[model samples]
Structures are given as C-alpha cells and as structure tokens.
Target: MRGKSAKYILKVDDDMWLNFDVLLRILKTGAIRFSLGGKCNYGQYPFRDPKNKYYVSYSDYPMSIYPPFCSGTAYVADSDVIKQILTISPNIPFFRLEDIYIALCLRKLRYEITNIPGFHSTKIYPLACLYKSPMVITSHGVSASELRNIYQASCDKDGSMYVPKNPQQLPERMILEQRWPKGKLARKSFKYEQQLLKHNLF
Candidate 1:
C-alpha cells in the first residue's frame, strides 16, 4: 500500500478495533482530499498562559495543524508524498522512532492531518459515547490485555449503544513516580528546555 497512489492510509495500533463501515460512512466528506487514521498524542510539555504556566492541551499549539498528536496511525498523500518526504536532503536518519519524524515532515509540508473519531479500543469505558457528536480520534497508554477485554465486552454486550466497561486498573503511584524520577525538577529544567527548542519558545 505504501508503494501505491493510495487515496488514504489507515494506521491502526496493535490493539485498536474499528468498525470500517462506520468509518467509511463518516469519511464520505468532500473537503477531505485524503484521509489518515491512527492514534496520535501531543508530546508532553507545559505552556504559559500569560498570568501563569500550565500544561498545554495535547491537541492544541504546534500540533494543532495535525490536531490529535503522536502519530502511531494516520494516512498520508500516497506514494508521492511519501517519496518526497524520503528524498529530502540530509535524509532523516533511520531511528527506532519513526512517527515523530513523519509528523515533522508532514508539518514542514503544511499538510492538514485531521483526526478520525471512534477508531479507538472498544474495551475502554463508554464505548457508545464515541458514536456521539464531537468524536474522539485517539487513546493513549492502554495495554494489550485491556484492549482485548474491551473487544470481548463489546461483543458480549450485543453491541448495545451504551454499555459501560469496567474502570481501568491504574498503575500504582510508586510506579508512576518511578517513571518520572526527576519530577518537577526535570520538567522545570531539562524537559522545559527541550520543549522550548521544539516549539521555538526562545
């Protein structure tokens, strides 16, 4: 599919379960010249709001053009766009991480990457709510088992529109804190500096 002139690309996470029929129905809009699907997350960073500092909404700021951020899944402009991106001078080095690089490329080209809602795990809570207006395009930090449970429960409920899934078992605070050992110091200093550079804050 990457080699062909695809009209759209649907990127799916390992755990995502989608209703293609429903997706097709919603994407019939003419404004969308091409479509991309996948889970995206805005990088973690804080922003200043005049009076004080606060964490920016992931969907806002530099990533606003891409809307939902962190490109695990998405569609691009077929092989042409892909080829052009790959051909850029000082070709981007091959890295273990690829999604951010792709997002940066699309950003440089001024492409509009919109979110396709209702394309997330069916096992998460309030699955039916995804069908409502103002759709949700992505989910983050969910494990494979959690995704499986969601799919199973969605099936068991006979596709009822409003079935609620069990609350997710969140990781312990000790674990969470372990993941961010430097805490406020790291965020206020090193992380802050990196974000400033990425967003051109200076």
Candidate 2:
C-alpha cells in the first residue's frame, strides 16, 4: 500500500455534509496525511440496540481499552502504515464495532488519533458551523432533523451564512463550490457541464 500518490482518506458519517472544495484545498496543503471525520450522534449503534446479537463494551472486558470517543469517523493512516497494519493483522476477528477497535489497534501501535473540534453540531441557532477551524471534526447528538435543517440551511441563500446563493442557482453553485472556489465563472460553467453530463443534456 506504500506508493506515491496524492490522496487522503476521510471517513464521514452519513449525516455529515462536507464542503468537498474546502476539503480538497485542505488536502492540497499536504500538512495532513490522514484525517478522521467527526461524529454526529444521530444514529443508533448495534451495541446500543437491545436486538443486536453481538454487542460488547469495554466494561465487559476489563483488559480492553475503550476509545476516548466513539469512532463514527476516522482517518486512515498513510499507505506505508496501512500496509504494515494489513500485513501484520490480516486476519483479525471481525468486530461489530470496527471503528473503536481500529482506533484501539492504531493506539496500541503508537499511531496518534486526533479529535477535530468545530466539526460537531449542537441544539442552538445554527445546526452547523462552517468556520476555518484548525480542528476538523464535529458531531451532532441524536438530531437527524437538525442535521437536515443545517444541510438545507447551508445550501440556502437567506438561511445559510456560508455559501449563500439564490435558490435557482444553488444546486449549480454547490457543485461549483465543491469543484473550484477560486475561479467563479469557470466553476459556474463547469457546473453547467456537469449538469449536462448528469442529465445527458449534452
């Protein structure tokens, strides 16, 4: 897995809305080799559900080390480290809670797993904050509606403090924003091209 390529792994929760353009810019800086997405505590885990057959916690096993936080999202290590882990533990037992298990394994191997701040959500006014935060992770606790509200609001002109565009141009603008932020006109045109391709309008 150790090879020279320009790529970064981001594990995002299903409910999380990432500004891909912003993320791409961050990746371009090359300061971060691996990144993990913050969790939004909206979904239920198998361990929490009473119906699950395989559910175990650190409390059950005294020797097991519990992760500092639940791992809804995490960054994969660089290719070399990834290869080492794969080679060393190719046939590890399949855990229902793979996120925490992976974190524990990485920690045991002396890999640093960082928690990104400002990437989370709260019950207050704005559902999400789109700040240029040094920390890159955030979570929302058990509020799917809030997540959707934040997403929609972020895409709205009047509602969103970030990327506010007219409703008619919102979709195209969003696509453009994801692709290229510096070249506004080019991004808009590129968005049109993308729409044509998606709808076979060409």
Candidate 3:
C-alpha cells in the first residue's frame, strides 16, 4: 500500500485458498497493528546444496539458520512497517526467496513476525476441514483448475457445498496435492452435509 491509500495489506500466494469474509473479519477486529502475522517459521536451515531451489550461497547468508520469519505462503502487513521495509529492502542483499527476503527486510526494520492461529497455511487441509474451519485457509501447490475448485468450494452459497466445475470429479480429484485419491473425498462431502444439517452454515 506504500502508506498511500490502505492501512494494511494482506499478501497470500495465488494457489492458496482464502475466505474473503475472514479477511474482512480480521480487518473489522481493528486489532492488527504494527506487526505482520501469518504462517511464520522458525529455526529454518538454509539449503547448502546447489541443486536445491532454495539453496543460498554462503556469501548471501553465511549463518547456520534463518531468523524467525513468516512463510511466503501468506501474511498480513501494515502500511507503516511496509514502508519501512521498502526503504530498507534496497540495502539488504538480494535473496531469491520472497517470503524469507521480506522477513529479512522486516528483521532489519526491527519488526518481529508471529504465527497467527487461524491462518491454516502450508499443509493442504481436507475439504471437510476447509468446510468446517472458519479460519484463513491456504492450499498451496495446487493447479489452476484445482485452485478454482477449492476457491469455489469455500465460496459456494448452496447448502450442498458441491464444487461447480465437476462435483463428482472434484471430490475425487487432487484439490491441492495428490493427497486425495478418487473416491476417498466423498467422506469429506458426507461430513459437510452432516454439518449443513446440524449447524446449517450458509
């Protein structure tokens, strides 16, 4: 936001699924200030191998481990800290990883990031979990079609809560990772239906 028009900025990976209502919910609380929060990681070791995607040169980062930082998957930052981070970002050496790099800049600005509980980040939760949980849902490493389905599932207004593109296939398809096989996903829908019957979540 560059301290121009917005008070806070929420950054989330494209593949990750989020409930927009949750974002509004977080903002309406008027509690988030000064600090960034998301799926924060700690004591992460730098990859020494050159073949790895996250490999960092000793010159770039010679330390044994990275400072506590938020995962790039998703995070929320305020305009004040964002502006400060921008001012210092140029000074810090370039690191390929955006999340880690942002955290480094934040570290330079003397801001600490903590993990927020509702940010169901990183690991892909089951459809039932996404249906039942009223948290920040993030399903990383999903394909374009799968991303669309997951997004649709969360946003679906029907009490049935079935995916639009291909309901039968969606429950069977790999929504995010290839964790779910063909027929196993029906169970998720079963629980969702049960919840619909019990709580009548719209």
Candidate 4:
C-alpha cells in the first residue's frame, strides 16, 4: 500500500491496540523514520528455543546479535524506509522476525529507530488514564471491548487520568495525593490522629 504514496504507514498486530491521538501527536513532531509502540531492543540476541514462537534457526539468521529493532506489536514508519525495505528485502536472507527484518533493512540504510513512550509490548494490564498523554501509543494483549473502554477513558479529564509507573504506589495513594491540597492533607492527617487517640486506638 505504501507504493500508492501514503506519507506514513502504521502497522499493528491483531492483539495490539493503538491510541490514535497519541500517534498523531508524535507524527506532528516531524521526521520520524521509525517509531515502535513498545520497548526498543538494543542488543537482543536471536531466540534459540525451537519451541518458542519467535525462535530463529541458524539457517535463517546466523548473527549472534540482532540489529536494534522495534517491538513487533506495533510500529509507524515513514515512506522512505518502507521504500528502502522494499528495495533491499530481496537481497537480505528471510528471517521470521518481521520487526527485526525491517530493522535490519533500516540498519543497512543507516536510519535510526525512534522511540515513543507508552507503546507497551508487555502482557501487563494497561491503565485507563495514561492514554491522555501523547507518549502512550500502543498496548498489547487487549481485547476488542477493552480497547473501546480504554478509548473512552482516555477522554476523561478528571485527576484520575494518570498511569502509575511505579507499582509500589497504589491507586488509593494516587487518589489521595491528587484529591487533597497540601495543607488539607496535613490537617486531615492530624484530625485522623486525634480521632484515633480519642478512641484509644493509637
């Protein structure tokens, strides 16, 4: 389809869910050669396990370290890179890793892969709120219904719209922090302590 002259092309897997708002925001920044939705692999090795879904046989790829590639869940590529891939693909040996295959083509063309935050490839459940940010691009392992739910939640303007980066801080803590003013928090804590003492619970 890229040959038809599309300026940009976004490719995603069936299980991968995308936040179009965030994607548009990134593209507006300009000159993006390649942007993957999830974590970027710098020096990843080939999957050696024959039983693994991503396993690569020695006949396919003999290289010890793969060229830096974007996670296959989702990625956006500029037309130039697409053309480059189409031009060089026949010359390169076929590999099962589609993402790496594209990456190898880019490497040969001397193009760098760009990174956009919030494009997750992990199986971890996604937080509904983070979609408001331009950084959050893709989430893997989401069902069709859940994708709609996430899109609706992304439109929410309440303080409940943040995605927690640290697992240690629970949602309750976040709510408390956002819901109360600094002075009010201190006073509220003090009053709670007083009530505890009055009840002889302290």
Give the best candidate by TM-score.
4
Candidate 4 residue pairs in clash (backbone atoms < 3 Å): 37-119, 38-119
Writing each residue's lDDT as its tens digit, candidate 4 over 1-202 gives 3457776888888876677766776677774744333357798988899999889887888889998888888888787678778999898877667899888887888888876665667533344554444545676776776566666652354323343344224333322232222465546556533432332210
Candidate number with the higher lDDT (3 or 4): 3
Q: TM-score ranking from best to worst?
A: 4, 3, 2, 1
Q: Is candidate 1 or candidate 4 better by TM-score?
A: 4
Residue 198 displacement in candidate 4 (angstroms): 31
Clashes of 1: 6
Cα lDDT, model 1, residue 174: 17
| Candidate 4 Cα outliers beyond 4 Å, as residue runs | 1-5, 31-38, 157-202
Error of 3 at 135 (Å): 3.4
Give residue 15's lDDT in candidate 1 (0 to 100): 45
Tell me the lDDT of candidate 1.
0.42
Off by over 4 Å in 1: 1-5, 34-68, 73-80, 93-95, 119-123, 126-161, 164-202
**Which candidate, 2 or 4, has the higher TM-score?**
4
lDDT of each: 0.42, 0.43, 0.64, 0.64
Off by over 4 Å in 3: 1-3, 120-123, 126-132, 154-177, 181-202
Model 4 residue 34 distance off true place after TM-score fit, in angstroms = 7.4
The TM-score between candidate 1 and the true structure equals: 0.44
Span of 10 residues, lowest total lDDT, candidate 1: 166-175
Whole-structure CA lDDT of model 3? 0.64
Which scores higher on TM-score, 1 or 2? 2
**What are the per-model C-alpha RMSD values against the true structure?**
14.5, 13.1, 6.8, 9.7
